[model samples]
Target: MRILIVSWEYPPVVVGGLGRHVHHLATELAAQGHDIVMLTRRPTGTDAVSHPTTDTRVDGVRIIATAEDPPEFEFGRDMMAWTLAMGHSFVRTGLRVLAGERNTPEQQPWVPDVVHAHDWLVAHPAIALAEFFDVPLVSTIHATEAGRHSGWVSGPTNRQVHSVEWWLATESDSLITCSASMRDEVTRLFGPDLPDVSVIHNGIDIRTWPFAPRPVRSGPPELLFAGRLEYEKGVQDLLAALPRIRRTHPGTTLTVAGTGTQQEWLVEQTRRHRVTKAVRFLGAVDHQGLVGLMHRCAAIVLPSRYEPFGIVALEAAATGAPLVVSTAGGLGEAVTDTTTGLTFDPGDVAGIATAVRAALGDSAAAATRAARARDRLTEEFSWSEVAERTAGVYLAAKRRVRHPVGRPSIPERPLPERDPGQSD
Candidate 1:
């Protein structure tokens, strides 16, 4: 199958889970003999003059960086303006490719068997391209702004995100979401007949992140949190729970590993709660640093209020770090109580404190459970397996587009068993 993947972010440049998801999915598809082409905005330092004003191949997959003439780098301005301008350029250039305006004998236009768009950020380009090319488009809704803010906030950026999401979901041949909760949200917002939506849970690279023997903490029992320090992530809730946690587990300490809008607020909470000494805020640790932390930590907590699919939980599970997740949104789907990890109700300070203490005290039992979780992750949610499942979705979209009616009745294959921690 020839697949053209449209996304706003890619590796060597990380915005969020969307970029990382696209990168891994594309690579896995290409490895499985699918002809893959990725379309994204040109990254920083892309030589407009030297860089092909056209298609280029990276790691056996064609990559089309948008806009032949990119804007000159300007320092000390509103970054959002620059991002919007670049996004526009990317969409315009992608539209041209889909329209077959820049075709060549050596590199023909992207006549994909499937047009797959990752998220709302690239929906404009994906929708335009699908229309121009007259191909079946499969869109993945990684997150919904409405779901993120729970309709409480509707500012300009939030509104725009929701608008694009609506357009993309309405236009797609088949829509894909990471969790069932997300599917419910989409149906509630868009009504039925919006699109033929499917749930394809996000997966991790199990081989690369095999379960290692976790290191025993010599000094303090380190409880690790690795994500954006925002309200949705429940960082504030974690911070608030720390005061009660330290009252019992004095040797317990927290090592935060990401930064976001709520950094200052989190710091304030730490100080006000007088648990600053127990918390070490290591802002934005890189991939290797995170893996190291996972191996060393006594427990890995993902207290998200609205996680579409907890990819981070899978990553930590793959490393044999017993999980502690909140019972909210997709997080409930990502942890099995006392099996893979334990769960606590969101904002239940006593429950969270109790869970943390329990996890810290029984290092040996947690290690045993972590090993089982790792085995489950590798068997059930490997990237290669998810890629094959996703390919089936692409084929389904193509078949529907090619023949709307009178097609031979085909029985749907029974989907793989929904792991207790999975979101189908």
Candidate 2:
């Protein structure tokens, strides 16, 4: 199938997990004998529009990037202005791709078999292109504002984000989510009209993250936490757990990775606990260094308040590091208790310490679990499997669009029971 993917971020310029997700998906699709073209917003480069891009060919698939250049608009510090700019850029790019596809003859058609878009950031373009080309559209909702806030308050910004999500779910032919839990979130937030949401769990490229012999910790057992440090991420809770954790295992050290707004609070928490020396604040390590550290660590911990699907856990699991994650959103789906890794309540500092200590205490057992983790990643979370499932969703979407003449339109019915981590 000739698939056109519209995303906001790509490799070497990732704002969040979405970028890496799209990157691996496209690569895997190419490997499966599908032609893939990516339409994404250019960071800040003034160069050729249809230039050679990342991992363009795999197996029989051909991939390319169609960069969108939006004229700079002064928002004057208004949040709405930023939203408008994003919308305009997406809409304009979608229109451009559609027009180009239409101009070409059917014998050598540029029109895509399916238009698959990654989030609200690229939804405008995806919707616009589908309308212009009259092609089926599939949208993947990664996370929602409600999920982010955890129901504290639904402010205007939150509403705007929700509004865009609603528009995409209503406009697209099919909806895909990372977890069954997310499928429920979509139905609850966007109403039951979403034509049977599908769950396509997130996956990692296990091959790229090659395992090497890790260095024995000359000093203390190293523990690593990577991601945006925030209240929702439960980094502060991890710090609170650290003091208790050290009393039991004094040789253990915690390494906090990634940067976010909660840096000050985390720093203060370390000071308040007086375990600043034990906690190494390694803010924002890149892909290579982070994976390398994972291989050598006692365990990789993620104490998130809520996670749609934790990709970091998969990486750590793939590298054979003992995994410890919070029972947040879809994270529970990723890490198996006492098999691949351990889990604790997002808010329970004591529980987190217990899980962490348990993972580190049984060195032989952890090694066994680590081996199982790497094996599980290969059996379940490979990119090839992810791409095939995504392709099936696109095919189903196309089938729905083609057979819309006689039969009753498939009413977007919400699932009877909430299924977390349910992807097509």
Candidate 3:
């Protein structure tokens, strides 16, 4: 099967779990002998003369990375404008790629059997390409706007983003989500008339994670929290719990890995909670550093107020790291309360402290749970297993009969005259 995968981020441009999900899915599909063409933006800017629309292969997948045409847009600062401008760039380069304008035999035009879009960022391009080519539009809503804001889409910018997400949900023929909770969220937000949403949980490669024996040895009880430091992540709750956690377990410390808009606020929170001396903010630790921390840490706790799916928990579990996660959205589905790992309520400061203390204090129980989590990954979250289920979705999408429709036109002017640096 010939498949075209569209996403905003990929390797070297990973903003979060979405990039890793797309990369693994594309590579795994290609490994299964399917012709996979991934359309993503170049990490480094490119122009016609300098480095235009690179076509390269990695792990049997053909990656066609296009550049920002106007080259004046920045994702963080000009989010809404950047999205509209990005839609134009995607459509322009996508048409050329489909038309095989290069004329070279190797770079000749190729028709994809189905178009799979990752999220709202690439929705315009995905819809345009699918409509123009008369192919099925399969979309995966990794997370929703309302979900991030805890079902509050009150502000103008938030509403604008929500409308785009609804447009993508309505335009696509088939839909996919990372978890059952996300599927339910989409249905609740979109309507009673949307198509069936397939629930395909995120995958992890155990070989890369490489499980280790995590017996709680004698050392500082270091609890690791790895993810974006956003409001929805509930890192503040973790900080609030730190002081209480220290009452029971003396010499306990926390190592925070990652950075976001809430970094300063979270730092202030640490000072307010008087855990400034105990908590170490190691902002934006790389994957290598993160894994090392996970192996050595007594336990990893994820106290999320709104988590569609906890991919970081899976990564930690694969490394035999004991998990103490909040029962928020799909996080509850990711870890069983007593079987695989300990669970707590979202934003519950006392719950967070209790769960962390449990994992830290009990060496035998923590090791047992961590081992169970590592074992669970092989059965349910392997990359090959995830790819096969994803392939099934593509096959079903290909079988759908699409009606001829006009492509969505990109506006000449950007979304707003002024730049609003707001995005999820």
* Model 1 per-residue lDDT tens digits across residues 1-424: 9898988787645678888898889888999999998887655556566654457777667777675345664322433455456556666777676544754667765577888998776776677667667788999988877767644333555555566677677778898888888888877765565668898788888766656787756786788999987777887778788777777777678999998877887888889788888899999898889988998888898888778888888899998888888877667776778887889987677788888878877888888778778888867777898899999989888523332322211113333342222221
Give candidate 2's error at residue 394 in angstroms: 0.8
Candidate 2 lDDT over residue span 1-424, tens digit each: 8788888777655788899899889878887888787766555343235432233443343434444334444333444555455556656554555444454366344678889888886667687777777889999999876677664223455566667777777777888999888888888877655676898888888877776544565666888998987667888888889888888888678888898777877788889888888888888898788888888898888999878999888888778788889978789888788888788987799999999999777877777777787888888887888999999988888524433322212223332232121111
> What are the lDDT figures for the candidates, one per model?
0.76, 0.75, 0.84
TM-score of each candidate structure, all chains considered together = 0.86, 0.85, 0.92
List model 3 lDDT by residue over 1-424, tens digit each.
Answer: 9998999888867888899999999999999999998888866345555756777888898888888775676777778888887777778887887664866667867888899999998989999999877888889999987788767566566677788888787788889998898999998888665666899999999888878786436766888999998888888999999988999888889999998888888888889899899888898887789889999889899999999999999999999899999999888999998899999999899999888888887878998998988899999998899899988987887424545534322222223321122233
- When 1 and 2 are scored with lDDT, the better candidate is 1
Rank by lDDT, descending?
Answer: 3, 1, 2
Q: Which lDDT value does model 2 have at 273?
A: 88
Best by TM-score: 3
RMSD (CA, angstroms), candidate 1? 8.0
RMSD of each: 8.0, 6.6, 4.8
Q: Could you tell me how far off, in angstroms, the CA of residue 70 lies in candidate 3 after the best superposition?
A: 2.3
